[model samples]
Target: MSLDSWAVPSNTGSMELTDTTPVHLIHVDPDVNMARFYGIELQPTLFGEVSVLRTWGRIGTNGQAMMVTYDDEAQAADALHELERQKRRRGYVPAGT
Candidate 1:
C-alpha cells in the first residue's frame, strides 16, 4: 500500500471554534527521535469531531520527511501537558520550548 496517500491533510477551513479568535499553532521540539510536533485544533471529516491533533515526524538525511498523527485535540493536549510536567520533574527542557 502507498503510505504517502495517507498523509495528513493541510489545515484550511477545517477547524470549528466556539470563539471567533484564531487558534494558535504551537510547534514543539522534543529534542528526541521525533524532530518536532505540530499542534493544531482541527475538525477533520474522518473523525467527525473538533479537537487538537499532535503530529510528529522526521526527515531523512536527504531532508525527506514523514509525519504520523498521534491523537485528536483533546487527547493530544492532555498528552503534551503531561509530557511537559514529566520533563519538568526530571529537570529536562520541556517540549515547545
Candidate 2:
C-alpha cells in the first residue's frame, strides 16, 4: 500500500476548498532527536461536509494523518486553527520561518 491511499485526494477541482493554502509546520532539534512535521488544512467535500486534515510524523517521511469532518466550514476552520495553535505551543514552527 502507498501513502496516497491513506491521505485525502489532491485538489482535483471536484471538491471545493475554502482555503487552498495549508499550514505547514516543522520541528527539528538534532540534540533532542526530534525532527517532525505537522500540517493542517481545511477542505470541503462533495458530500456537503467540511474536513480538517491533519498530518504529522517524522520529517522526510509521509507520516501519519487524521481527518475530522464537520457539518460547516466554520467548525472545520476552527478545528484547524486550534490544532495549529496546539502544535505551535509544542515547539512546531512555520516551515519557512
Give the Cα lDDT of each candidate.
0.41, 0.87
lDDT of 1 by residue, 9-79 (tens): 77665454342222222233467544433332333335544444333333222332232343455654454
Question: Over the full model, what C-alpha lDDT does candidate 2 score relative to the true structure?
Answer: 0.87
Q: Specify the poorest-scoring 10-residue window by lDDT in model 2.
A: 9-18
lDDT by residue for model 2 (31-50), tens: 98999999999877778788
lDDT value, candidate 1, whole model? 0.41
Tell me, what's the RMSD of every candidate? Answer: 12.0, 9.8
The list of candidate 2 runs beyond 4 A from truth reads 1-15
The true-versus-predicted C-alpha distance at residue 82 of model 1, in Å, is 0.4
